[model samples]
Target: MKLWFARVAGVSASQMLMVAVAWQMYDLTNSAWDLGLVGLLQFAPSLLLTLPAGHLIDRLHRGRLLATCMAVQALCALALAGASAQGVATREALLAVSIVLGAVRAFQMPTQQALTPLLVPREVLPRALAFSSVGLQGAVIGAPALGGLLYALGAGVTYFVCTGLFAVAAALCLWLRYAHSAASSEPATWHTLLAGVRHVWHHKVVLGAISLDLFAVLFGGATALLPIFAKDILHVGPWGLGLLRSAPAVGALAMSLALTRWPVRRRTGHTLLAAVAVFGLAMLVFGLSTSFMLSMAALAVSGAADMVSVVIRQTLVQLETPDEMRGRVSAVNSVFIGASNQLGEFESGATAALMGPVGSVLLGGVGTLVVAALWLRLFPALAQRDALVQAGTAEPGGRARA
Candidate 1:
């Protein structure tokens, strides 16, 4: 419970910080390029530091590490607040802080993922993951609006609020108690750093699940073109664009709640593949729909389908991995997630430029469908797997569950 609240508050604080930072940057420079640079600078550190951070997570105490991350984020928020209050916040300062946040996130993400299985029994992990998604989706939906409201009061006020949230989250993390201990002390070397990559490469089920998300989202994402759809095709303006943006998260939150109530218990692999296929079908509907209502519905369905896939994939990965290696394996999984989202946006933009928006979306949808079909044949072990917890695997908490 402490972990759940910590995750919600931490995620909410992070989202609010992003909104305030982006608005502050735009207010100062009014340059789209500068805004894009902020995002790039933030992402760059994750690419460089995540693997090493994962190694440290395995060797150190995860809860303490997460608390430290939140503390650093709190300090960053305070710095931004101070700068905003002094009317001295600059583009350069924002860019540098973004790099710091990115680096902290590289550690925070894997620590959070690796810590969950330690806190919960393996039998309830699927439901716990589903419940966790509910909080995340809610924060993703609500925090930005809260930040915008707080920003109207002042950017300093928004930052102050974020600082408070981070502090509270850090306190919660510090309060958490779990049974798992850190891995045995090992010298940091190339072999240890690359273990995650090697593990993923050799574990065909993990490889299939993670890569499926990478390719599926890489081809099927249409978020980059939402503005185009709202203005030209739907004729709904900014208000409608906001709805389109929120629609998927709304669907995901609802689906997560359902999954928590009645978790997937059988044929988990086939279920994951079907969910991805449904997501493709939803994207296809969204691409072809002329009605705003239809488009909104399609996006909602896509979100719900994607939620199913997320719950299954995360549960599978956590259950398959031993406690000692969870941090490293989760780091590899996070990279796949980050790549799919970043590259998916780029793919959507590039294809939108070559073909029209509708055509690009249609192509992406078809491509996603084809990938789903191909993966069924490509990963037979995953497709035929019957249970989320294998018959005789050791759980992260160290007990073997049948």
Candidate 2:
């Protein structure tokens, strides 16, 4: 539990840095497209390098690898701080630094996920995950409000503080101890890489789980465009922007804690779909609201709905994956997550540029709803399977019966 809390602190710090960057970039450029570009730059390296990083995790010590990645992330944060201090805060420089951070993330996320099973007892994995996620919520709730305050101080100071936080996170990583899984006995080859891809793509359950998140988050994530709404529509400043960023985390945190006491035990598939649908509706309400309080309320509801989806999706992934293949599979999972988030940002920015921010957000909500309905109709096997299926006990639905 202590280890999980430590990991959560690191994750929360990283998220704070990310939110700070997004808010700062929007302030600097005053352009929604530029804000979206930050996500593209930050996630581009993960999209490109995560597969290779996963392969490396399978062949290396995950603990050492995670520690190394955190070190690099710290350096990237410091470099960004230096760049900002030097008054060299060009869009290109911001994009470059973001890419460097993304490169670090490519390995870090998979290593962290794969490392968790090593740190906790099998029966307590779910609880550990919940605890880790709660810390992330803490960051989400506090970081942005603090980040926005810090950003109001100056971009350079805000980045320097983030650098310091990441440095602390690196030090924390060094304190964690875990045994590595055996190095891949198989030779590192293109065929081996392809085999990992084949395994995830062909697995109906994995594919469905990743796809569900991909489509829902891709279309439903209007939170990425918050700065625009906060500034242009709602007429709120950086602090309100931070509050907007934190709303979903608030919702997610509440739900995560509630579930810790009463975990999701049945109808997982139907629940996930319903949660996403509610998320979409919440987003639509957020998009159209002209009142500041109304916007905040709507965003909070969206956050709550998103929390439900995250729990269900994570439970599905952890319950089904094999120990040996976790690294590679988690890499694929990172790609899907990164694509949905980063690409969704790009889409939001582009659409906002073309059709105005309110219109773009509303359309995204509608699209999320459409995707959920389609997924439910098309992926009947996934829709039917509501509980984790043990390897030997997989049913026709590809999961164990609840």
Candidate 3:
């Protein structure tokens, strides 16, 4: 629980900084393309380093790696805060901080995820994951809103608060304990580094789940263009932008809590597909709605739907992967997730430049729906999945038999 709390604080701080920086950028340039540039810079580190980072996670103390990453992130936040104090429109400096932040993410994601299972027993994992999801969703819901409020006071204040949050996270991480075998002794060879890539490629269910998110949310970058909506379309101030940014997280948090109360024990695959489709539909509604309240409602609904898939996909990937392979596999997973948000933002920006924000968002929604439908046919194994918890210690392909 201490670890979880620390993570929540750390993430909350990051989210606060994220919204503040994005808002600052949009305000400076008044361009959707520049907003996307923020996402792209954040994406760069993960794209370059995820594979190596995964190998390192499997070969290092995951807890230590995680703690170290948090500390670095705190430094990055501090740097951004320093920059922001100079002026609100510190786009160049904020963008530089993003590059550092991306490097932190590249190392942080897999280490954090791989460390999760080690914190609890196998039987307790699902519940733990559920609670973790709720915590994360809650952070998303509250942090952005808080950050927005802080931004209203001053952008520098928001950045400093974010720095403090990262410090708290790092401190808490020092106390969390776990037992593990010695780090992997394998040489960091090309073949060895690529092992995770091959593993996810061969695991049909894993591949399907990861790919679904990659495309679904990749196109779902409609959320990335939110500064435009808040400033221009909705005419909401920074506070409203924070609220708008947080809507999905609120829905996701509610859904996660419900799942925690009554876990999904059957038709896990079907649930994932249905949830993605619902998410797409909600996005479609969001794109079309003119009223601020209605738009928030649509985004909230979309977030609720997204939580279902996130839980299932995350649980399935972790449970199916071997202990030795978990870090690498998770690293592969991170790339997909990172790309979906950052690259997707870039895509949204490019398309928005051509077709306009509304058109871009609407098209992305349609694309998300199409991906869901196509996935139902493309991944028969994933589609046919039933249970989330395995019956015994079965390998990935043989889990059904177990």
Candidate 4:
């Protein structure tokens, strides 16, 4: 729980910085294309560097790697703060900083996911994952609120607060520990990277589950073009923009906490599909709603429903993957997940450029539903599977299965 708390703090700090950056960028440029460009800057580095970053995670001491990344991120935030304070903040500089931060994130995700099982027992992995998701979602909710408030005070204050938070996170990282093994001592190379890809491709359940969420979220990604919705359609300012960004996180947090008591059990496949379908419907609702309250509510609903898909997909990845292979497999998974976010931004940006933001979002919702329908037809075996948990099947170290 202590480690989880620290993770929450760190994640919240990062997210708050993101919200501040997005708002500041939009305010400075007053363009939807600029909004998408921020995402693009972040995406390119993660997409390009993920494999090497993941490999390094497996090879290095995870605790040290994480601390270094946090330190770098803190410095980056401080730079942004300085730029903002001087009235020299430019969109180009923000994009450059975003790229550096994205490179840091490329290394962050795999190391974090690979380290989870080490902290908690495998049996409670699902619960732990749920809690972790809660932390992330909670940050989504809180960061933007705090960020908007800070922005109201001044952009410099927002960036300063973000820098301070990053420093706090770095200090907190010193308290979290991981149990290393012979597996982590292996060499990192191109050959090893290829092996990881092969492992993921051969594993049907992992491939199917990751692909499922990737496709669904990729097509229905509305968050990418939020600036347009906030300014034009919803007629709200920075505070309202923060609220719109946070609505999904609120819904996701509610669902994550609820799942602690009633864990997802039987018909896992069907449940995943159902949750995604609901997400699509919520997206459609969000796309159509012009009222600020209604649009935020719609986004919140979409977020809550999407949490179901996230838990199932994450649980499957943890439970199915072997410890020795966790880093590599997760790296492959990162590509898909990262692409879903980055490419989705590109898709939204390109589409919005052509056919207005509202139409682009509506079409994305339609695409999400269509993909879900096709998935249901293709993976019937997944739909028919019982609980993801198996009684006698423990992990390699006699630990209970995730």
Candidate 5:
């Protein structure tokens, strides 16, 4: 748990830097497209290196790999700080920093997910995941506001803070004493590397659950446009952007607390769909709202709705997957998650360029609803799942029971 908290702190700090950088980029170019570009650059590493990174995690000491990754992230943060201090934080330089940051996370995120099973007993992993997510949700609640305020002082100050937090996170990784699964003895070969891909491809229920999240969030996410909404749509400043960014986290945190106590134990499939549908509605409401309070409320509701799917999907992925392939499968899952989030930002930016921000957002919300409905038909086994634990007991490499 200490390790989890420390890593969460690092992730939160990185998120803070990201928020400030997005604000800075928009301030520099005053273009929503650039904000989207920042996300695209950050996620490119996931697209390019995550599969390999996942392979490495399975074949290496995940804790040590995480420590190395965190240290590298710190250097990237320090470099960004230097660039800002030198008055050389051009859009291109910032983008370059984002590319490095993205690559580091590409290696870090799967290892992080794979590490969870190592830290706790399998039976209680869902509960542990809920607690683990609290660190993230809490950080989301606080870090954006902190970053916004820090950036208000100076962008360099914000980057320096990130640098320190990442270094601390790196140091914490050294203290983890738990034993993780040993490296796979299989020789490093392309066939072995692609095993994780084949595993997901063959599992209909797992594929369905993952695909549901990928498409819904790919359309429903509106984070990349928050600065635009803060400045133009809501007439709020940087602090307001922070609040806008934090609203969903607040909702997610609250929901996480509730789930920690109750835990989603029944009819998880229906619940997942319902949560996603609510998320879409919230986005639609947020898109049309002129009032800041109303916009925040809508976003908060969306965030809360998103947590249900996150918890359920993550639990399903880890519980159903065999121990030997957790890293590779998680890498695949991260790719889907990264595409949905990063590419969603790009998609939002491109669409915002063609349509107005409000129009683009509205279209995305409607598209999210369409995806939920379509996925319901496309993966009926997933939709009919009754319990998170009992749903995927069959072979992960075989057909899903309908």
Candidate 6:
């Protein structure tokens, strides 16, 4: 219960912080290229540190690590608040903070992912994950709208509110307790560092699941261009940007609640592919729509589709992995997630710079559709997968039975 609330507060704080940073960056330079740079900077540290961080997570107490990450984020928020108050908040400063966030998230994300399975029984994990998403999507829904309203007061105020939320989340994490295993004493080595990578490579279903998200979202993500749309294309202010950002989460929250009540039981693989296709279609709608309501509707549909994919992929990964390897496997999974999100933002920004925001988004939507089609051919194992958990599971070192 503490862990769940911690997730909600932590996610809310992070979303608010991101809203402020993206808006501030756009305000500073008014360049789509610079907006892309913000995402690139964040992704760089995660790219470098996430694998090693995953290894450490397997070796240490995960709850403590998560608390520490939250504390560090609080400090980051404080720093941003101070900068904004003193009128020294610049693009360079924002980029530097992005690096710190990336570094912290390298540990935070996989730790959070790895921690959940420990808290719930395997049989209930799918429902737990769906329930978890209920909180997350709620945070994602409300925080942006609140943050946008707060931004109207001032950026400094928004940062201070984020600081407070992080502090609260950190406190909650400190109270979290779970079963701990300290048995693995293997020394760090190249082979150990790459264990997660090798594990995913051997598990074709897992590989397909993660990589499908990577390429599909890499091409389909339009988040980086939201500021451009809010300002130039949609002609809505920060308030509207908040709503646009919240739109997807609104759909996601509703879908997550439904999933919690009635989880996906069959046709899991085909359902996953179809959800991605729906996400692509929604992106196309969002790219073409000039009406605010239409765009919101499209983003909402995309979010609902994404919620289905997330629940299935996360459940599949957690169920297949042993406890000892969960951190490392989740780390690899986080890398894929981070790539799809942070790197995707960079891709969106670069493409937007070249062809304009609408063109970039339209092209990405098409590319997402293409990737989904190609993946069905490329990973037949994933395509043919019948259940989230197979009847006969392989050992830790063997191929995952599909």
Which structure among the candidates has the greatest TM-score?
6
Predict model 6's lDDT versus the native: 0.90
| Pairs of colliding residues, candidate 3 | none
Overlapping backbone residue pairs in candidate 3 total: 0
Best by lDDT: 6
Regions more than 4 Å wrong, model 6? 392-402
RMSD per candidate (Å) reads 3.8, 4.1, 3.5, 2.5, 4.1, 3.4
Candidate 4 lDDT over residue span 220-265, tens digit each: 8877678678878888876787788889999999999988767898
lDDT of each prediction vs. the true structure?
0.83, 0.75, 0.85, 0.78, 0.85, 0.90
List the candidate numbers ranked by TM-score, top first. Answer: 6, 3, 5, 4, 2, 1
Ten contiguous residues with the weakest lDDT in model 6? 393-402
In terms of lDDT, model 4 sits at: 0.78
Whole-model alpha-carbon lDDT for candidate 5? 0.85
- Candidate 1 residues lying further than 4 Å off, grouped into runs, are 20-40, 79-95, 151-157, 180-183, 222-244, 285-295, 349-363, 398-402
Q: What is the per-residue lDDT of model 1 for residues 1-402, given as tens digits with 9 covering 90 to 100? A: 888999999988987787678667756875444654565566678778868988988988788899999999999999999999999999999989988987888898889999998877887888889999999889866776677677878889999999999999999998877764646778889999999889889989999999999889878877656656766789865446546766787789999999999888889889999999999999999999999999999998999999998998898889888878888888888777765664465567667767877988899999999999999999999898887766765487542121
C-alpha RMSD in Å of predicted model 1 compared with the true structure: 3.8
Q: How good is model 2 by TM-score?
A: 0.93
Model 1, residue 205: distance off in Å is 0.6
lDDT for residue 363 in candidate 5, whole number 0-100: 95
Worst 10 residues of 3 by lDDT: 393-402
Q: After superposition, how far is residue 65 of candidate 6 from its true place, in Å?
A: 0.3
lDDT of 5 by residue, 329-385 (tens): 899998889888988998888889889799989999999999999989999988998
Q: Per-residue lDDT for 261-340 in model 3, tens only?
A: 88888998899999999989998888888899999999999999988888888887888788788888899999999999
Candidate 3 positional error at 22, Å: 0.7
State the number of backbone clashes in model 5.
0
